[model samples]
Target: MKIYFDYKVQDYLADESFRRWVLDGGFRNQDSAWSQWLLQNPDYAGEAMKARDIVLATQLTEEPFEEGYFDTIRRETMGAIQVKRRFVRPLWWQAAAAVVLVSGLLGWLVFYQAPSPETEVATQENVPAENVPFFQKNTSSAILPVALPDGSSVLLHPHSELSYHYGPAGTREVQLTGKAFFEVLKDPASPFLVYSGEMVTKVLGTSFTVTAYATDADFSVVVKTGKVAVSAPKEKNEATPGNADNQTTIHLVSNEQLFFNREKAHFKRREINQRDMLQYVPATHYAYAFEDTPVAEVFRQIGKAYGLDIDMEESLFSGCELTTNLTDEPLFEKLSIVCSAVGPGTSFVVEEGRIKVLSKGCNQ
Candidate 1:
C-alpha cells in the first residue's frame, strides 16, 4: 500500500499555525506512529513542509487555492487506485497523471521515514559538477576566500566552504560551518544569502561576520558596516538556530552585534565598541563584558580566546561572580591576575597549554 498522510494533514503540517497544533496535538507520550515521529522533531517538520510545498506547487492550477484542493490531494495521497493511467490516457491526461506519480514518491520518502532532527542542516548535497563553484584556501590568514565570477568576495574562516552558480540567473549562496566575513559587492538586483544550517543572513551591499560552528553553543552575527537582515529558514525553528522558541529577527545597524543561542532559542542585540568588533579577528586584542558575569563563564570565554584547555571544578564557581577587565592580557597571565583578585590561596596549574584553576577562596 502507498504510504502517506492525507492532503489535509499535509497542509496542516505545513501551516505555521499548525506548529502549535502539533505541539499541543496530544501526540506526546503516545506510541502512535505519526505522533512518535513529529512530536519534538523540527527536522521532521521541515521535511514534511518541503514535501507539502512540492505537492502544492504542482497541483495548483490557478491564482487562488481551491476550497477542495486538499480533498483532491487526499485522494491522490492514498494508493494509486485513483491515479489516472498515463500510458492509455490522452497526452494532457498522461501529463496530469505524471504529477501524481512524482508527488506520491515524494510523499512516501518524507512521510514514511523522515530524517532525524539535526543541528547541522545541509541544504544541497551532491551538487552537479557544473554547478559547483571553485574554492581556494588562504592558509596565511586561515581564511578560505571563494572567488565569485562577479568580483564579489566571501572570506571563509578555517574549515568553511562556499558554493555558487555562475552566469545569468546566478545567485551567490555560501554554506558556512565555522565562521566567515563577507564583503559583498553592491548588487541590488541579485541579493546574496549565506546559509549556515537554518540561519540565513541576507545582504544587498554590506560587510558582516557570521559564526555558526557545530561545536559552538551559539551563533553570532556582527555587522561592521552597512545593513544586514538575518533570518531563519521557514522550515527551521522560528527562533535563531540555537535558541528555543524566541522568534525574533535581529536587524544589525552598522557597528551592532547580535548573538543567537541555539540551545535557548533566543538572541540579544548589543551596541559593541569598535574594539569588540576586532576581537573575532585572529591575533587581535580580545574584549569581554565583565558586568556581573559568572566566574565560570568568564573562564570559559578566556579559554576560547586563548586557544587553551581550561578545567575547573563545578563547585568552585557555582556562586562566584566576577567584575574585572580581560582587555589585553595573554591567556595564562590573565587567568593569574583574575585569580589574584579572588584571594591569595587561589592558585592554578598550567600544563601542556591547559590551565586548571585550583583551590577555593584565596587566603589574603
Candidate 2:
C-alpha cells in the first residue's frame, strides 16, 4: 500500500481499493487505509483528488461492454503498467487519462460534447426508443472479419473489441479497442466515424488501420488509401460555436501515419514506413528496373511500389533521366541509388519519415 503513494494517477484509478474508496464516496470506514495515506502524504493530495474525479467520471456501472472485453482491458492495462514501471516515470494525470482513454472509459467522461442548436432540435424531434448498442468481441485466435450494415468491413484482431450503433439518420459510429483494419464504403449522405479512446477518425471512403491496444503506450492510425481525418476529443470547457466542428483535426492522405502518445497527449505525423506500406499491397510484384526512364516516372513507380509519398520539384527533374536495375534493395538503398543516378549533387533526405529530394536543375 505504501507503494501506492508513489503511484501515478492511472495506477490509482486502476487499483481496486482506490476504486472502492471513490465509489463508496470516501466514507471513513470504507477505505481508511487509503484516506490515512492521503493525509500522511499531503504532497500527493492534488493527484489523488484528480484521480478520484476521473474514477468517478469514468466508472463503469452496468457492464455495458461484454465480459470478454472487460477481461481483455484489465489484462492489457495491467500489462502496460508493468511494462511502463521500468525506464520511465510519467505525469500522474496524463497517464491516468491515457489508461482510461485506451480502455474506452473516456467516453463516459469526455467526448460528450453538447450539440449545437440545430443538432439539439433535430435530436429532440427524432428521439427514438432506447437503442441497445451492439458490442462485438474477437476472443478467438484468428482474425475476425465483420461486415457492417453500411457495407464497410472491419478485420478485428484477436482479443480486440468493437461497439457500434447506427443512428436514426443512417450515420455509422463505431468504437474500437485494440487493432483493426477498416475498408469503409463511401456514402456521401452518411459518413463513417470510429472512436478509439480520446481520438476520432472520420472517413467517407478509405482503407486504414488503427492500432489502439490498451496496453500499448501509444495509439496509431495509418492510412493506406483515400483520405481520412483524425482529431482529438474536445475539452468540455473549450466547446464553443463554429470551432466545435473542427477541434484539433488533422487530415491524412495515402501512406500517412499519425501516432498519439498517451502519456504526453502529443501527436506525431509522418509517412508510413515503406515495409509497412508493402503489407497493404502484398500481391503486387514490382520489377525495379528503369532504362533511360524519365526521373519523374521513376519516382512515381517507386512511390507506387512502396506506397510512400515522395515529394520533389517535378519541373527541376523534367528532362532528367535515370538508367538503373534496382532489385531487392531496402527503401533507402533504392532511393540512394536513384538519387546518384539522377545527377551529381542530387540527394534525398528523410524528414519526419518523408523523403525530400534535394537537387539542382538537370544541366540544360
Q: By TM-score, who's the top model here?
A: 2
lDDT comparing candidate 1 with the true structure:
0.55
lDDT tens readout by residue for model 1, 1-364: 1233443445655655344434545344355455455555555566655544454455435687655667645743342232112134335434443443333223222221233423112212222224545443333444443334343545557665555554345556666777877666557777777777667788776667889887788788888656688875333434356554444456776678888777665667888887787765333233444766777787777766534447887476676676665433223335554555454445455332245777564222
Misplaced by over 4 Å in model 1 are: 1-132, 136-141, 166-170, 233-248, 281-364
Tens digits of lDDT, candidate 2, 105-217: 21211112112443443342332233335566788775554544344656677789998777677678889999887767657677789998888898876678888888888
The runs of at least 3 residues in candidate 2 whose Cα sits more than 4 Å from the true structure, single-residue gaps closed, are 1-132, 234-246, 278-364
- lDDT of model number 2: 0.65
84 Cα displacement, candidate 2 (Å):
52
